[model samples]
Target: MTRWRFAQGVAALAAVLLLVALWAGAPEAPEAPIEALPIADVVSERLTTLGSVVGLAGSGDSHAWLGIPFAAPPAGELRWRPPRRPEPWTDTFDALAYGSPCVQLASGFGGVSDQDPGSFAGDEDCLYLNIWSPRFDAAEVPTGDDRMPVMVWIHGGGNTIGYAGSFYEGSLLATRHRVVVVSVNYRLGALGWLAHPALLAGAEEGEPKSGNFGTLDLIAALGWVGENIEFFGGDPDSVTIFGESAGGKNVLSLLASPMAAGLFHRAIVQSGAVDTVSLASAVNYTDEEPPGDSFSAKEVVLRLLIRDGSASDRASARFFAEGLEDSEIAAYLRRKTAEEILSAYRDEPDSADIRPPRVIRDGVVLPHRRLLDLFAEPGAFRGVPIILGSNRDEIKLFLSQDPAWVSRSLGVVTRVRDGARYNFVSGMHSDLWKVWGVDEPAAALSRSQEAGVYAYRFDWDEEPVRMGTDLGMLLGAAHGLEIPFVFGHFRFGDEATAKLIFDEADEPGRRFISDAMMSYWAEFAYAGTPGRGRSGGLPEWSAWGSDVGQFLVFDTAADGGIRMSTDTLSTQGLLARLEGDTNLDQTEKCELYRDLFEGSADWNQATYSGLGDRGCPPESLNTARSD
Candidate 1:
């Protein structure tokens, strides 16, 4: 009788276990095949306003339509002008490959390159966009309430480099999250942001003359999405624009731009700051009394004329350039090859990188007011929900390559020369970045806009120790490192580069964090608030509040997992912290202060002068460092 009772108890326990398993449920299955959707047949063709486009198969049950022109090529006569709608075509367009990247001097770090670094790559006619969506049949395309939210990605390279290349492929994000992903290419460098008066001599009356042609390119791309995203199973009314670094800066520009209003519903800026060029800085000669940018339109023209043997020296070149009529100057500039025009503005004598003034505040495209001021004023800028974020060690990416802070072996392996000094400088700079890019902006937007303003600090730094190098300590949540995690892509550059930063041992934690980030991003796109993420199972991400230091910290379980924190940063607070530190001498402190003051938007001469009277001149600060 006891044995019989035991058997019955065991059966009851088994039943309960089965019930629990049913309630908990299993993981979502891999993406469904096209045939599984409620459609008559699979169709990879999409009819757009420009033409009918056929897409190719993409990773993980997604379809990709690449090289679709949204605007007329901004080349020759169209250069430096607002983008116009592309001429329509009758034949079916094969959008199987990406368009040429916008013209830029190649950099192995961010810019596109097939040749050696510093060599020029890409083309003048590169106003195209790529789209990725879940594979669907023609008859089963989602419409009306079922249409998915759309996300448009803007690549970052200081607005001078980068392209919508394969490195940022959107298949994983789109397929996994059930959202439409679009990546765009815009004009870069001087070809996109020149503000010479000669180019505007015969401009039409209502045309934007702000010399922010790159900004206009984004506006035009959003316009395209608004008109035609429905054909790709996306809702036109629910568009979110997101970017990193300079791309994030562009997102902020769109928020400030009256021309870009109503084009996007939400925005996400990852490590982006507010910086705009003045009209004088964009057009004046560097030698003028108030002196313009070293690579201003006039300065570049002078250099080009000298390089062409039309003038012997700076004084003579300026004289020759000033002698030309407006029409003559316009004709002369147009006659120069793209290479000649680009090479004239190299950042260094031997480097092909050019850092010219961009996003001009010409009182038309962008308001004359500053971004923070505009955000503080109700209704002055777009009131959409915004997510502002920065990495924990934002400066480590650049500093890791600097010879002053680190030593490299064979130009591949690297080690920090002075760990304490390296951490101190990187931490301070990174904190300042948060002050400018995330905290300050979040506070301003929260005060002005009714929509939710969210803030985040990405703290996932799990790089492996390879070749006696501790990558985690060296890079540690560095700038641009969060990009792949956001997109669920781990592969960047060759296998060696990928292996150096990511290790198979860390895969489980890396994927967990990536999944959490994507969930938060997609949820925000869907409802303008990340809330408890898509599943409503993660930690709640509260919007910015009146209290201090409210933000979601993204990390893995091994490193505290996803949680909220109350740690905040400010210019005054950072200054105080720096003053109290005993790790560095007065000279070092002043040098660091110089860099901070130069980078800070709240530059105050009085505050800088009060720093120990260490003889640090505020004039020594490089105002062009942000570029």
Candidate 2:
């Protein structure tokens, strides 16, 4: 299509949206029963243009109307803009095959090819949501009854990756827990988050005026659920928001955002709850100084636009902005191709754009400037029940990405980038040094004190033989590994739990861990504790505080109860010395420091565990021999 024609088309689309959104989300009918199943007990059949698919598993009884459109296809002029509710669909749209994933570079193989499986089938017109519930198993609920709680899930992808497809589906959770499961697809990477000043201007007044369009899209998705979920046998009154990795990062942001208040009742943050690790990845990215410490989303958008198409032409951007009225924006975007629009809104974000990822603190979502303050405020959040935990060796996967680690698993020169690498090895020394001197723990403990906190550290690595290599040697309790154990759904494709990432001694290894994890997850979702069903007769856990940092420790041994480390206190004390202001730990800034340049690779001879036991810094092992 010619540029002028595209421009005209876009102008028309935007005009229509303004009128519609002003009147969107009117009340809808209670869902009707669609289908039933033994595995799920109940299913709601839905038909979309793509085809027919059924919504299964609500809190015992579920009501479904399939083919619901969450947002207008982010086509043509609407390409780089914030999402809009679809101009009401006129026909029975199919809801079976998940719509294409949002377009972007595929996930990193990182030598774990079979394990990662990267992303598949994506496009710009990808704004859809799926919901499930155990309640669907029941045909009816008494009127005026708020029986089931709701959970809206946002998958993790470093702000640029992840999928909403059923392959990573959460139906089992719905069937088992009898809660509403809502999984959604939002814009990712440059398309989803790049924030330019132009975007800042277009935002409406009084209703979440800001720059990060991707974050707002999620807000829009929740807005839809808040108004429509009750019809599907859900209780909007009490909702628990949850996710792992990048998803958990978002849970913190939503908890802080005033707009998200009254939208959820409880939350679950797994494998990632504290700040600093990826704290830079969250919200409040309004830093406009000469390339400051925090990331600036607005800068990324402009740079991407310039690199791709006519974004460099300030005049064209202004033209694009002016024409954003009526249905022109959405219509024009739909008519033009994704590749075509990609040019003006480029890809391959430069270094600056990539750093400022998911869950940014734009003051609106996270009013408290820092992590501790956000948690400290009583009125900031409703202080709901929370499930937060991590894997024992969360970084072990990356450490194993070294050549020696791969050689053991494959029994050959595998695809690792370098030879003989480990997180506590030479190349990883820099990251190791940073952790030793950091002190964000006190702030995190503060959050625990403010809310109902449940914590755990997963440490499961089985041994034996596999491909002539001990898989157990490759990992401990690394990031994202806890997910499968919780659901007992380890094998994603052909690879089983034992084969995918481990060399199990026997099949019992997978079964034992799976059973334990699945039970824990179900019990938590059911009753808010890992031992919710009263099956395991274990010690009662007391919530944590700035003073008492009690936490659950899941180990290879079944009876691996609680583990405490005084090291945490020392770490907190050291933090009292960096370059920030906080009662938590404010360090004085010094112009000169000892050994400013430490050879990272020096730690090849020392292990983190070895250093801790030998009266050395638990982190010094990240460097070379230090000789």
Candidate 3:
């Protein structure tokens, strides 16, 4: 779109929005006394740190500060380095439009991809953040007596895709919950993650030299929020960090990172699993890929050099790779454009094959131990109140998109019927998530901080998917289904997916679930306990403990809405039930056990041994195990 047309669109949107703000009794931008000067057309506000005004545009009840820079653009020589503070400007900087997402693949491969219309297809200078607040006018800015809670959202795209702007519109949470919502944009793909000896050559002696530049970007945004949110009428001391999927995993990382202490007061993880790699694994290319090498920063640099005709053969490439000085290699790597480095990982046939471990166990930012091990240690976490949970059918999103890939990833080659495959995949991922992602971590946190950890399961399956089959049956409570509900954004993304996932038929359940979630999440941000100050008749959510693995199940049932339940359906207990069911022959039982749990990391050796004593057939179990 042309600049003229874009400006016209902005004016039209702002004009329509003004009517809503007026109806909502939102204050006009102040003017008169210099301190009370109000912004016009698109409502705007000035932050305390920069003292530069930013225009707000979006739906009326709230003002949106889109594409606000938190750090200097990490491009050119700054490509692989930690974010530097953005340069201050003397004049108002227009934050009227959404910023481009960090450079990433256009489609889903390793994780969910952001395909929004203005994800502007991707860029290198994407360290921007967006905010949605109910009060943005100078007159509405809060004084010492009345400050709103702040929620900083980290969007999930497997740490490879997604941006801060369009997909995660925060109006509903801001308006309905009376909180300030900030969604952040961080670096993605190889540009955000490539750590090498050369890349860290000139680093300060004792600093973190790991590749998790994406994690650093997030830390920078949090630092920015803690400093400037008060200018937007948000209480900086009451900040809550929340995310889903990869974003959720990031929340876990922040909790475990020593550098992140005091940045956020609360954290919530939804379907987030943590995986860390050692510096040895990242730089060595020891795992398998093409040419008998792992997909790492070394391979990416080699590809760029070969593509540019700097080195014609693998031998010469190896010569420069191993023989060159660390500073020399760092300089050469920094000189390459963002695209040249990212192109190496962009060509895999499927996302499943190429998802190399990205979060590293660097000593400075992250500890050397695995995340789960760290969670188990006393006081290892930031000692903050936390909420963690998963969907009932987390794997359905993957199965619906590509069953073959889902099956392979699930480690199943059984020729079971489609219905059975669906049941197996969904049940397997859901149970495993509860065991590892939710319950275990909650149990650990509970031991450290009593009544400080909460767990939940989103089971609302009334999505109005327009696909041929009933969406409730096909998608169920799938991965990311909880996100739109949390944000109260029933319509998601560009076109058909929104209509398919939520339509008139799904309004009642959507409204009910969204209201409850917003109330629960926002209340936690306010009082550090969900049930403390809520007047909305929300269910009393209990905390999870080692012995008591309680969770608030979010579903729209005929009898009651949200209810607290115990962990009766433990992974081992569920497998035992499948084994003891007389209706299923030995073949089905063994196949179900092996397909659903055997090869998974969540598998319990003790439970498997008990099942063997329960007369599960040796042959069927053996066959499924062989693959």
Please tell me which predicted candidate would have the highest lDDT against the true structure: 1
Candidate 2: which stretches are off by over 4 Å? 1-68, 80-82, 89-93, 108-121, 135-138, 141-146, 205-207, 273-358, 403-450, 493-498, 502-512, 526-539, 558-627
**Which scores greater on lDDT, model 1 or model 2?**
1
C-alpha TM-score for every candidate: 0.90, 0.66, 0.82
lDDT per residue, candidate 2, 1-627, as tens digits? 111111111111111211222223212223545854323123454333333344433223443332245788775666556667666554434444445567543432111122222223257777877776544333454225645667677765555555565434555555555656687777765566543344444555554544345666676778777766665566767667776665665676666667777677667776443332121332223342223223333333333344457355645644553455534433433454443333333223231113324444555545535544556655645566666665655554444433433442223323333333332332122222223211232234345445466655566756343333333544545556666565445543223322444444535665665565555555555455555333464444445545555555555454453343323323233323321222211111111011212222222223222322132233332132111
**Which candidate number maximizes TM-score?**
1
lDDT of 1 by residue, 1-627 (tens): 111111111012112212222333423234545753222112778888888888888888988888899999988878767788889999888888889989877765446745565688888899999999998887788999999999999988777778887878999999998999999999988888888888877466777776788999999999999999999999999999999888898999999999999999999998887767777777889768556777888888888888889999999998898889988888888888777777887756677456644688878888987787789898888799999999999877666656778675545335789899889888998898898889988988888889999999999889876555677887788878788899998865434356556888989998988999999999999999999878788899999974554899999988899999879888889988888888788788777877666644555666666675364555565544332
List candidate 3 segments past 4 Å from native.
1-43, 108-120, 204-208, 287-293, 299-316, 346-357, 403-417, 465-467, 568-571, 574-627
Could you arrange the candidates by TM-score from highest to lowest?
1, 3, 2
Clashes of each: 0, 65, 2
* CA RMSD of each candidate after superposition: 12.9, 13.6, 10.0
